[model samples]
Target: MPLYKEIVCNENAKLYLWKITEEIEFFKHAVLLKDVSQKRVDAMKSESHQKGFLAVRMLLQHVGYTDFDLYYDAFGKPHLSDGKCISISHSHTFSAIAISDQPIGLDVEQVKEKVLKIASRFMDVSHLENLSDAEKMKKATVIWGIKESIFKIKNETGISFPKHIFEEEFNLESKKTIAQLQFNAKTENFNVVFDSVEEYIYVCAFEVDPNFLQ
Candidate 1:
């Protein structure tokens, strides 16, 4: 399939999602990969990973971009050669990328019971209280995606999820919330929006103006 969904996050940002239903060879023959990306794709032992990588390229092409227009930093953060902020993520059968004029982060995680089991490792389990097992799993996955999106925005070293990123209380129905990054004796706030895509939770975070949160 082509673009599974397109989300206009704000005046300056957009998110594109791809559903990976085609065979690996299909993507291998479809998108053009730069030397680095080609080598990286060729070296990947997992077909799933390769498909996800190529699907990302297909997404860039969907948005009038090519692999040549993208690059990565020493920290492995992706950047557009034209100066747009970009974030990429893929899980199992889906892949997604977000482009923005503002600093942004995005994540998509498949809803799975395993997130509930390890909730304590990355989030406050108290937030799960009163929820049924299924809700707990869904909420935990959203929280994980929140932290991951923030981490991608920061892309800085030593930022731990449980210790540094904190999500404010939010209900699943709200589909939006606030978060804070407390690290290095400084604090930053982010605006968060998320939704369910098929069985996955898709989350996007943007660095917010301090006054905007008030």
Candidate 2:
């Protein structure tokens, strides 16, 4: 029940962060998960869910949702009976969820070197050309998060990066960034917000109503 922080992104959207100590029982009862995986169960054994159910349950709580009565679509996209659009992402000991009245996507990634090696696959040559040594790593990770968020929203995987998706760079000092996604025969776009946590980076993208798609 301990909320670490909350960010008011807009009148319609808000983000929250929670720190779970010995409150594992909170999730156990909240989700009604009888036989969660050992990894998840073990996370309860500790103060966190290391790739476990804690993340999901915490997310549910953040959105003021209590019903464990939920199911996943064919692509593993979580669906609620009320039809609220939601997306989730988790890393090591932390997890994040984004819920919105409109279609939204979210991703949390541990900043690591592996993202650098795969940058070329997801980032266009033009993007690579504009990066300096230090900027490249951060830029690549942001791109990965952007694509991941898009994939979650689309409910499909294996989408080619850089090739199929594109992002318009924003000054890190700015309040928002823009990401544009193009699939086989369709194109959509969103306004994204980026945040830098301790060792991880989080990105959220949602459609700009009346002018854009999510």
Candidate 3:
């Protein structure tokens, strides 16, 4: 498929997603990769991984960027030449990137039963209370994405999902939530939005503005 979806996280950030239905060649032919990205893709051992990698470039091109405009820091956080804060994520058959004037992070994951199995390891299982089996799986995936999105925004060492991040209890229908991160003697809050496309759950996160929408 082409671009799967776009998210307006806030006035300052936008997110793009790609569904990896086409073969790897689709991405190779559609997007121009700088040499480093070409070399990285060449070394990928899995075609799905290569497609996922290239799919990101496809998204970059979708947003007027190329591999040439993206770079990584020592900690491997992605930066754009124009100084926009950018975050990238892909899982299974989906890939996503968030571009923001402010710091942001995005994540996508296939909805799978396995997330429920390990839900307790990373999120507050109490929030899963009251949902049926199917809802449990979906909610668990959302919570995991919330934590992962927040972690990517923070991008700091020693920030364990189970130890430092917490999602406020929320009804699934809300489609958005507030989460907090407690690390290094500080507490920071984030605003998160999540939704499902086909069988995948995608998340986008931004630091909460003091006047954030209630």
Candidate 4:
């Protein structure tokens, strides 16, 4: 499929998803890549990774953008020539991009038992109590996505997922929650929204603005 899903995170941001069903040639024929991008894609050992990178470029075109408008920072975070914020993620069979006028984060993780296995390393286990096996897996994946999204927004080194990012207790039914990033002697809160697409959980986070709350 071309564009698998599109979610309007808010007035300023939107998430575009592409389900990876096409082969490498399909994406190569569908979009153009900058020379640097092409070289990076050429160096990928896995064809899946190459497809994911091209899928993101396909999404850029869907949003009226092309690879020419995109660039990466020293940290490998993506930036747009137009000054809009962009975050990219891909796992397994899915790839996504989030674009916004304000700083934002995006993550997509397939639900799996592995996340629950190492949940302690990145999150509080108390929040997972009393859920069925399936629920536990999904929730753990969501929390993981929350932390990842926040990290993208901060884009700073030495930030430990377990030590620095914390997700408040939230019901899966609510499909939203609050998270805190405590690092560098500062604490910051983010407004998080998440939803499940197919078997993957996608989350987007926007830094909380106290003035906007007022």
What digit string (tens of lDDT, one per residue) describes model 4 on residues 1-214? Answer: 8799899987889999999999789999998988999999999999999988999999999999999999989998899999999999998899999999899999999999898889999989999999999999999999999999999999899999999999889989889888999999999999888999989999999977554322
Candidates ranked, most accurate by lDDT first:
1, 4, 3, 2
TM-scores across all candidates? 0.97, 0.78, 0.96, 0.96
Residue 30 Cα positional deviation in candidate 1, in Å, after optimal superposition: 1.1
- State each model's CA lDDT, in order: 0.93, 0.66, 0.89, 0.92
Q: List the residue pairs that clash in candidate 3.
A: none
User: Which 10 residues in a row give candidate 1 its minimum summed lDDT?
Assistant: 205-214
Q: For candidate 3, what is the TM-score?
A: 0.96
Number of clashes in model 2?
Answer: 0
Q: By lDDT, who's the top model here?
A: 1
Worst 10 residues of 4 by lDDT: 205-214
Worst 10 residues of 2 by lDDT: 31-40
- For model 2 the TM-score comes to 0.78
